[model samples]
Target: MKNNLTKLVKKANAGDKQSLELVILEINDLIYNLSLKMLLFPEDAKDATQEILIKVITHLSTFHYQSQFTTWVYRIATNYLITYKGKKSKEFAMPFKEYAVLIDSGQSDTVSYAKNAGELALLEEEVKVSCTQGLLLCLNSSDRLVYILAEILEFSSKEGAAILTITPDNFRKKLSRSRQKIRNFLTNKCGLVNSENPCRCHKKIDFLTHQKVINPNNLRFAQFTKRSIDLVDQIGDLEKAIAIYRATPAIPAPETIMKTIKETILIT
Candidate 1:
């Protein structure tokens, strides 16, 4: 499956727009899902997917096959996100009214809270929707970019190093610091156990994934945080934390994208 997918990707990279679109469509759900995980808004996820499609089309020929095509695309999306790091507060929220219908075709059937019989009445189920939101709140644009690339994208230490344009050793150090920052925020402010309790950290990662979370046993989060949650609480007020996201003081969207394509992508 991975190899055939790679063949399709290579074709797409060679300028097969239809194949490219198929590849994009093939991964669209996870792309949307990942965007939502990082951007934390439904509309933003949709918008990001749309923009990412344009980028993938424009930049396809540049795909060097150095990494798996998905990883390469992930790098592009993350970098575009970093460069476009606008305020997060304005991102479109998912609508509760149409929540069930907005389901992505590739969504994971993961559950977070266990169920057997009547369970909600007595079971002390933990909800960390806001904790995920709050963690994004604490991280700066660069920090969030690195953290998302590492955790949500499931990039290996070496892979993340390549994407971030840093050495693997350096990437590990930065990752450690990012983890520490999250732990500190939780412990100092909310008084949660930093590293002693493994489940809490796991729950935090799961919330960030933003997938179907009804069944407790099915929720599979990024496992990097399984051992620790000692993030440093250096984060301050929410006002400063948010750092208003702006869309690069926009001009017309299509024209800009076209210009970017012409300038960045070299075609035969």
Candidate 2:
């Protein structure tokens, strides 16, 4: 695959549109699938895919064959995912709805213009893509990035760190913290804590953890309830993070993921 990719890259660099499109077509699964799972939103996934492809197209001439072309491409995809999440987080944290509304000129009057099945399919794809957009709304971009890479996508900490331009140790630390916050939020809202009972007192919850670091043997799973709970118990020798969060429920409401995906895939 690498050798074939190298050939494709050589051709793509020489201005062969077919070769360029073919290369992207071949790797689209790797690029888009990873982004989709990571972003948990189809629109953002599409956006990340398009952005990475654009970078690949523009920088084709600069690619040094020192590493597998696939590795270079993965790195490009990772960067775009990270940047996309950053902007998305800003929007999620503080949405600009009125500004956004001004931009939607209106839907095309397809019936009057003579409708086609392809147009309907395109609309359907747009709707499905919206799911990916909202998937990471519960997380901050940093947490979203790590969770996408480390948890949902199952990238090892080392690999996740490489893509995000962070040290593995730092990535792990952030992952733990982020997971803790997300878990706490879920438990509070949905009562989905791994505990045996929901009626457990806030005292017990306070003593439990938000997110535990994955052990060398247990990194395969995202939710490490026991380790995190133990760590919380250790920390709350006086008081814990969970107790504090539970004490004050956060203010509510959200962002739109579909729009992000369209921006991502279409890139205009």
Candidate 3:
């Protein structure tokens, strides 16, 4: 796949319009998923994905094949995300200490509005995804990116450092710190990580639904085709907290966004 992308990159750099579209098609989902993880809101992620794709297209010629093409794309995406001052970024700008307090304040035993077992399951999945994504926002951008790349995305320390332009040791240290931060929070607060915790996803379904934070008709993260448990089964043994993130399904980029990207690329 990498070899094919490399060939496409060469063709793209040579002004082949179809190759350019293919390259965008190939990486759009990845970029969107990364953006969703980074930004924590699907609309914000979609916008960021488009912006990142434009950057990738505009700078395609500058990629001299010195590293993995995906690495280059990650460098671009991470750089933008690190500096992005999107609404969610500002809204979620708080330390884990504060975030924990907020989590503790929510009522866990609120009545759920789900009509049946299936509806309740969907609601639970929505809350789980929403809550985990919120946890990522507690970390500073640099640490968040490190955790996403190393823990969730399973990038090696060397690869992560290369993408972030930091030393591998630094990358490892940051990932360790970020991992511990999240693990500590989840261990104490999230029921999925530790059954003793009172914060069950099903418990919060009522509040989230009542508040319209998660609409049953339109889920942001839950894929109807595959449940979260399916993802969990695929993830091998790992820290339960980290496994939750690793188990997150890659969000597919909206086809409308893809269309916009292709049009933008053709115009450029």
Candidate 4:
């Protein structure tokens, strides 16, 4: 994918309009998904995605074939996110309502969580997904970006450094610090990380439902295949820690989001 995208970028840079459009269309989901993960809001993610693509197009000539196209593309994205601040997630809350119906309808039965539960309970399960994503907001934008690149997105330290335009050593240091921060936060506040914690997902369901923040019938994040956070060898039982963070899903932007990106690209 990266190689092909690099080719498209080269074509687009040479002034091929079709390749330009194709480049934006093909990477729309990737940009939007990253934006959503960083901004934690659909509208913001949409706007940011459009803005980033425009920036990418405007700066297409700046890309020297030195790095992979993805690295180049994500550098633009991570840089924008590093300096860009949108909504304040002073508390970890997600707009589950925006995603619920779409996700629930498209959920695969092969996915375990979607199968054995009633609608409402399943929706509560999805809250865990949003909750995990929300945790990214706790870190400053740069740290969050690093964590997203290195941990959630599974970028190697070298690849992450290339994307962030930092030295590999600097990238490793930042990644280590970011990892520590998240692990500490989860260890202290999340029941999943330490089973003895009082903060259970089930316990929050009633409060969340009564607060009108979630609707079980229209579940979202819970339906996708869950992914664990990158295990830091610095901490607890590596296996258990892995299992805890693994429960969080690596969510993709929905088709609607992809369509919205396409429309935004056309309009711009």
- Among these predictions, the greatest lDDT belongs to 3
Q: Compared with the true structure, what per-residue lDDT tens digits does model 3 show for residues 106-167?
A: 56665557778787777788888888888898888999999999988989999999999999
Which residue ranges in model 3 land beyond 4 Å of their true spot?
Answer: 229-236
Per-residue alpha-carbon lDDT of candidate 1 for residues 100-166, written as tens digits (9 for 90 to 100) = 2322122223434425422321121212332344345345556666666675455778988887677
- Report the Cα lDDT for candidate 3: 0.85
* Error of model 1, residue 35, in angstroms: 2.0
Q: Residues 1-268, candidate 4, lDDT per residue (tens digit)? A: 7778888888888878778878887767788778878877665777788788878878889989987777778989988977776654434433334323222232222332334456534655655656556666767787778888877677898888888888989988888887887776667666666677566565556555554455566655556633232232333655443345444555565566445544665445
TM-score of each: 0.55, 0.49, 0.94, 0.75
The full ranking of all candidates by TM-score, starting with the best, is: 3, 4, 1, 2
lDDT of each: 0.49, 0.49, 0.85, 0.66
**Model 2 ranges off by over 4 Å:** 14-16, 37-41, 85-135, 186-268
Q: Candidate 1: where are CA atoms >4 Å away?
A: 13-17, 86-127, 189-268
Q: Which candidate tops TM-score?
A: 3
lDDT of 2 by residue, 1-268 (tens): 7788889889878877667767766666677666654554344556666666667667778888876677677778776766576344344332223322211223223222114654333332222222123324556567777766665556789887877778999999988976665555434422213343232222111111121111222221112112222233443443332332222211111123233433553344
After best superposition, candidate 3 residue 224: deviation in angstroms?
5.2
